[model samples]
Target: MSHFGFENDIHSVLKLDMPITNAPMARWQRKASTSTSAHTGALSPSKSANRSLSLSKTPSKTPGKNGKTQSTPSNAGGDRFIPVRNAKQMDVASFLLSKENEPAEESTSAQANQQANQKAWSVTLNGYDLEEAKILHLGGKPLNAPEGYQNNLKVLYSQVPTPVSMKKSRYISSAPERILDAPELRNDFYLNLMDWGRQNLLAVALSEQVYLWDAAQGDITLLKKMEEENSYICSVSWSKDGNFLAIGTSTCKVELWDVQYQKRLRCMDSHTTRVSCLSWNDHVLSSGARSGLIHQHDVRVAEHHTCTLRGHTQEVCGLAWSPDGRYLASGGNDNTVNVWSGAQQTGVHCFTEHEGAVKALAWCPWQSSILATGGGTSDRHIRLWNVNSGSCITAWDTQSQVSSLVFAPNYKELVSGHGFAHDQVSIWKYPSLAKVTDLQGHEGRVLNLSLSPDGSTVASLSADETLRLWKCFEKDPSKKAKPAGASSSIIQQHIR
Candidate 1:
């Protein structure tokens, strides 16, 4: 019967249980007007000395020697004389009035100069003279606004906006693109056994043998085979040009091989223990060992051993160089992540938040200052650090042991491989750390992960003796792919 009862009946029918209160409606109230005003007076100009009253100026005097007076020099450049002629005295007001009454003639040069010196105070926007009301409505305007106010708004809203090609959300295949049998791929979390080279070649170490799979040709080649009884390939890395491959072996030796020629360049033995991880920064090869020492080898020179970094107290497993080659990040079995400043002997920042061994390290390619590190089973946290600040930016618990982390160069996302609970590779949106999707196929721990040169595919090696290539980050259609063998040309240029 009443409005409140009708509303209550409607709510009851809709199954909404909101409490109804009999509150009074709001009403407008007028404020009391006041005649408060301040009295103002017109400004009067300040008095100044009239130039006509004192036309004569005092002559300046120069300082004399020994305070003796001397005749002052004439400041006038030429003839300081003027002919005095009889003239009639006239009132200044009459003189001004006569000058105003004269016919004015403006010179062309003077008019041009004046026009050139003056600046336009008004601006023409989109061929429309903007008024005050139009400017006020630049953001938005009311419905009852004047017609002129809509000119700017019409100009702003009329042009067809660039149709932003809405990027279709990439459909990541739950199934892998290609699967290859990686027999005897070591299950050791401390060892980095796979690397994707810039030449579109994927290198994988399976015990005593190292194999290279060319993505372009889809051909497998045995790059190297160990003949020694106890020696095995522990880690693998490729040079920036992708022409040379660096292999860390169990016998505490680093072998450099020329990929194009298929020949061993040289062997640089520095580590006393097995080399666990290797990274390349231009010509410098950084090798991390189980003895907790990292050696910098100048592969270009005969004296390959250049420097040693001593910070990790245990096995140094993870090694990644920043994209710009400014900093090198290493993770060790001591549950610490150490950031070293370019070939330095000690770490600049030692992060000890990880309770488990830190093994996964990846630098953001887009942001040079950002470094991502993941801890082992005990910690299971993926921490992003601002390397410039020497502080952790953010950390996320993976719940599963993080074995590897690699940032997608094209997308603002991070892909991490996990070990226990679920041997799954997870795609996480960065900065937010929101899980995008979990790629589950590996039966065992996903021990290693590497991104391809084009940043489209990820090569993941698991302890289940399988290497899966997933096309998670697809390339933009507008961009053209790099010419074939571009890295080979780069290497040839270096050789020349």
Candidate 2:
């Protein structure tokens, strides 16, 4: 039969019962069968000539390796190209209609052979036992080996050394825990107007008045208010027992008051100039004045004046008694730090290291011989000194005026209040002097810093008339908090 007649017979045999209208289904037939038009009319001569020329130009087979002729798909380079599918290629319709196979146990001897090979390898390894290890230390001269040393591979297990425990890191909250409006607070850098007492009370002197904030009760009490004009409070300090508070005035007077009765116990007028700083050492209260004189007053007797210390040439703005009460540290506007022995009337060591006014001073609670002092804007340095040796241990440039310094009672850390450029509070690691965190919120220079009795909170006062409290130090959870004013009874007996 003719080729066209054979293709027509095959199409008639494979045709479905229903008529299909899809173009793709129609075009899926062999190219030779689809070469004629649906109207069955013969092509024009020009079109037939062009088709014969295109067919002659396209080579059906390409010459491949070893004189082999490979058949190339006829539709590969055509305009309406359809890819020829191979057995390895996926059938999307078939895959979409296919169902998952049932799970069955594979019974192939290849897996058993693999297991047998692994068992043989493991048994071969177990035949040799390594009971000892000998290490050859290379790079050095050869040493004679002991007799009967075997030259064989051996393994030895050594006990691992325990790792050293790392020190716990400290975290300080950057945000202020509490904020209070301190209206009319003095802006003078020479004044020390804020102090946290051992009774858990915060004493803040605002211009002409002094107030006591009870941390336990969350109440404010008017400790004392100066009614006279031009007579304002310059400094405030709490006694060691927290039963009394010392008030320094701009009028060159120092007044002692009993907080329990809210009455004045006695007033010391030994200072010729304004008293700028006050520190209590047991029954004796030391006051630093603008005259550069430090007066020791015995509050128990009618004659309160004891010994007068004359070392500073300018106003003495900072004073701190050592934890053991064996030494007294005084910082003055003369840029000098004077350390006085308890029994001597003159300073034992007068450190002239600071270039600016030294008003910030703190004694290490853990080390009685170490003292920390900070300088004003001209100096901007924090110096740690060993009072026993009269030598500076270390010093750091704070870059800002140091206004106040307070050592954390329970921690080996120090908190400093700064002014001038940055009105912020800084917490420093002791000995290392590395800064842990900077707590900032004040709009003006920080003028004062005080630590709570528990040493967990720090109270900062700034020239902007705002008082901020930060939870800078954390309390030791292993130890219980001591009762406030436990030693007050003993102190009260002496006062009574």
Candidate 3:
């Protein structure tokens, strides 16, 4: 079995034109009795001298103390390269494949496999990336895309975005998303008139009748009609869960309606004067009265006011509870904003900045301590306060009478509806106190404002007897689908 003779046979089978030069390399072999090649020949002495070098097999692994190798055993008959150094080196295929797929490999450095990690996402924009090479992380998963990441699906390859376009203020629709006539809506300034619920229903009071308008379906249902003479609907507040609607009337009686059944569930007539304003916290209903007193009614089982809050000198017209349902903000014609800690029956803090009546009240979405209060024609200012310390954070002169204010649930902005000259809805860039835009459509003074659940739209009811919807802010369902675990520190939010 001359090695050169075997080479001639392999060369005849493979039909090689170049002569075999590398000797220490191994050649293909078969079982002792069978071979794949059909030809047979004898090798020369020079080639046979190098044949031994190629015939060497990889070294075998030494048995460990536990008497076992941790790696998978290689198949003896599988196609593999036999390293000349040892007999049990096993197969180097996995390692060789890994390097072949590497960004740089010696033999094919210039033409290495260009495939990249498809799940990777590299960031390069300012504030979005720490540096050009730094990979972004989401839920602790690194987005270290390959150097030339054409296959990275997590990244978007495009032109650099314009910064000025992003920082610019947004303008809302000049026309409403909807317009409906509130023919019987009361024009009184001291009355709390309407509220929107998470159930996609807007409850509006028309004279003595309470109607529920389905914002999603455009269907309206009369929830209740006053049964007593001279009794009319004055205030309406939706329960936190949107399962019920609380109605306060001119009879000083507060009634709860189960929205699911469209029927009255309970009634409480504890106030001496007309029930003018209403707000809800969980199962508790707080009703502000023309008597300048606030009464808390436990809707769970009570028929009377649970506890009375005596603070205002005049009518308590505007009222709001913190989202947590732990604190309350009350505005009275006495030109005062009362912040009450739920722990106490009386107001723990009182702020009197507005010279006229304070009617508009809104709690900041991001900063819970911050409260916004709007004044009447004489004051014409929207003031933000730190409820905990009773310090005024910022205030913006609306110029017109501040009728109502509501904070965008998702974005850091608050919208105020004004009366008098403008009768406008002004959206300010929140804590910054910069006006983003003012929307005007109503014919008369804007009396009340309410926000839709899921925080997409706002409904403003004006004294012109028209209800308008403002499509203010909407959330991207895709980014919302991302796991909440993504860190805001590196999160890139598109604000428009």
Clashing pairs in 2: none
Say which prediction, candidate 1 or candidate 3, comes out ahead on lDDT. 1
Worst 10 residues of 3 by lDDT: 487-496
RMSD to true structure for each model, in Å: 32.7, 20.6, 23.7
In candidate 2, how many Å is residue 153 off? 41
**Candidate 3 residues 1-496, lDDT tens each?**
6999999888786766766665453353333113213327876657654554444434355456898854435765334765565433434766667766776445464343322221122232232333332334343434333322234344433244433323333334555666778886789878878899989999888889888888776777877899899778899999888998889889988888889987878788788889889898887778999899999888767455679888999999999998776689999999998988776766778988799899899887777778899999999998888887888888778789998999986666788999987998988776777776778889989989999998878889888888888776765433322233533232111100
**lDDT tens per residue, model 1, 1-496:** 6999999888787764655455443221111011111224532323112321222233355457798666665655322566444434346657777766665563555577765544223233334334433534455543432221323343333223332322332456677777888877777888999999999998999989998888888777888999999678999999999999999999999999999989999999888899999999988899999999999989889999989888889999999999999899999999999898994455789899999999899899889999999999999999999988888888999999999999997676899999987899999877767777889888999999999998988988999888888887866744433424433121100000
The candidate 2 region of ten consecutive residues with least summed lDDT is 487-496
- lDDT of all predictions, in order shown? 0.79, 0.81, 0.76
Best by lDDT: 2
Estimate TM-scores for all models: 0.63, 0.63, 0.63
Candidate 3: C-alpha RMSD after superposition: 23.7
Error of 3 at 57 (Å): 99
